[model samples]
Target: MTRPIAKPANVKARTRRRQVSPSLLRAALVLALAASCAFAVPVVLGALRPAQSADGAGLPPVQVALSGLAAGACMSLSPSGSNAGKTVFIDPGHGGMDPGVVGTVGGRQVLEKEVTLGVGTRLAELLRADGYRVVLSRMADSSVTKLSATDSVAGAMTASAVHRDLVTRTLCANSVDASVLVSLHFDAFDDPAVGGTETFYDAARKFAAENKRLAVDLQ
Candidate 1:
């Protein structure tokens, strides 16, 4: 028609423009496939996942053994050598105002609370041997120990004010920014003949791997 005016773009340019359409179509197809695959990925992964039991496989059970270490309220780690870096809190169950369970034998009578402090003291000595800094909730069994017990509140209190005071002292002394408090308590029962040893710790709370190891060692 009117010689098509003198075309600015020649046949080659027109051919190139036609080629571009296919490339754009291919790109669009690829993006669509990618989007569909993205949606399918999670579902496919979920389906391939293994089924799990409500109760998972448990860790191997452990038995504690303390052969060489001494026994008291609890044996302490050496605070001067291997124990130098650690701060250990040792609490002797009952003292002073609280003379825990009284034992009756044929002719001998033993006091639970008094005996615990004796053992705890011996234990602390052993811990000091290894290099650990040791602190006792109470230094002795007397009126002063009772004073620490009743120093807090009014006369109205729990079973053993002395025991409560010892715990208070331990928590107070060990509350340093990062410290481990090990409260030592002896077992008491209706029967005087029943006796055995037990140890406890919170490995999670105190970063207390060392304490646990010590306990195992002393067991």
Candidate 2:
């Protein structure tokens, strides 16, 4: 006979965090970046714009001003149209069996996968039109890696399958010798009022400084 493991304390009282999914914040960021690409300019010089909350209310002016200041620091990085010779890798987060955070808009259900794919695809198109070679992790509503029969268990993605899929995205970027890799994701909280742009970078990576600088510019 085996004993059942006890659940963590306060599990019932804690507010559940919805899985991070694409939101208005991400859509704003991606569209802004895409517009920069359309101008054939380095992304740092792009203008920053205010994003709306979940309820379509505008963000505070202070947040927009701060983002502008962060972007200003990128002016020293590159000259105009430097991206023409670069290869960019765009990874649209979550797909296939993973719907990520399911939220509602206009009283209708919206899937994170759909939002991410739309944003990523548009970004790729704009970059390509500006003479940058772009590679996407997945071009459709499917897994980045070839799905194995055992990839899913009990209607959820298996741990190994998740790992394999993520690894494959990195491998795809590496294969193309990508100049910049942009993995897009949106955030969510239990509170429906939350909404804002976010950018993340690995501080421990060798290119940490560069990554951080780019993140700051994007944010």
* TM-scores of all candidate predictions against the true structure: 0.47, 0.63
Error of 1 at 178 (Å): 7.1
Residue by residue across 124-154, what tens digits does model 2's lDDT show?
6666556565557766777776666788988
**So what's the TM-score on candidate 1?**
0.47
Task: Give the whole-model CA lDDT for all candidates, comma-separated.
Answer: 0.38, 0.51
Clashing pairs in 2: none
Count of clashing pairs, candidate 1: 21
Q: Give the TM-score of candidate 2.
A: 0.63
lDDT of 1 at 63: 13
Candidate 1 residues 61-169, lDDT tens each? Answer: 1111212111222222224344355445556655654554454444455554577677767766676566555545555663222344445455433546545454455
